[model samples]
Target: MSTSLYDADYEALRALLKILRVNAKLTQVQLASAMRVGQSYVSKIERGESFVDVLLFAKWCEACGISPGVALDGLRDQKRPGRAR
Candidate 1:
């Protein structure tokens, strides 16, 4: 079994988060405030220096007015092109 994310997975995760922020019409600072974290934390996540586990993921989704299920589905559905099913 794999122990890490594929490059496409990471890119997809980053894109999902960015899209969420944009859809919420939030600046990084604004999202940080709502998530009760520092702006750098949000930046780090966006830059893929950090990742959210399930609990934090849920919290982030809540803060962004998204459902955690949708985020999880996005993460799972970002299968790399040409990857065997």
Candidate 2:
């Protein structure tokens, strides 16, 4: 796929998680602890190996000191109803 198309395929929620983690200078363990989850869970999220529900997403944003609106905006723009990329 072209870069643009690939960007569309990229899971925005996962990207947001990673960006938040990096911006906060927190390791997976640190973020996991702050979010009350296992380090492996954070790792899995970074690797795009799992999907997080809205509630968990909100919790993660809060832990990173980010507004849920900021975290969710990218995802909302990319996703479409009844469409699979």
Candidate 1, position 36, lDDT? 88
Best by lDDT: 1
lDDT of 2 by residue, 3-67 (tens): 33125345665776888889988888898999899999888877876667778888888888989
Please give me the total number of clashing residue pairs in predicted model 2.
0
Candidate 1 stretches greater than 4 Å from native: 1-6, 80-85
TM-score to native of every candidate shown: 0.76, 0.72
Model 1 clash pairs? Answer: none
lDDT of 1 by residue, 1-85 (tens): 5434446666677778888888988999998898888999888888877866677677778888999899777667667566553
**Which window of ten consecutive residues has the lowest lDDT sum in model 1?**
1-10
Which residue pairs show backbone clashes in model 2? Answer: none
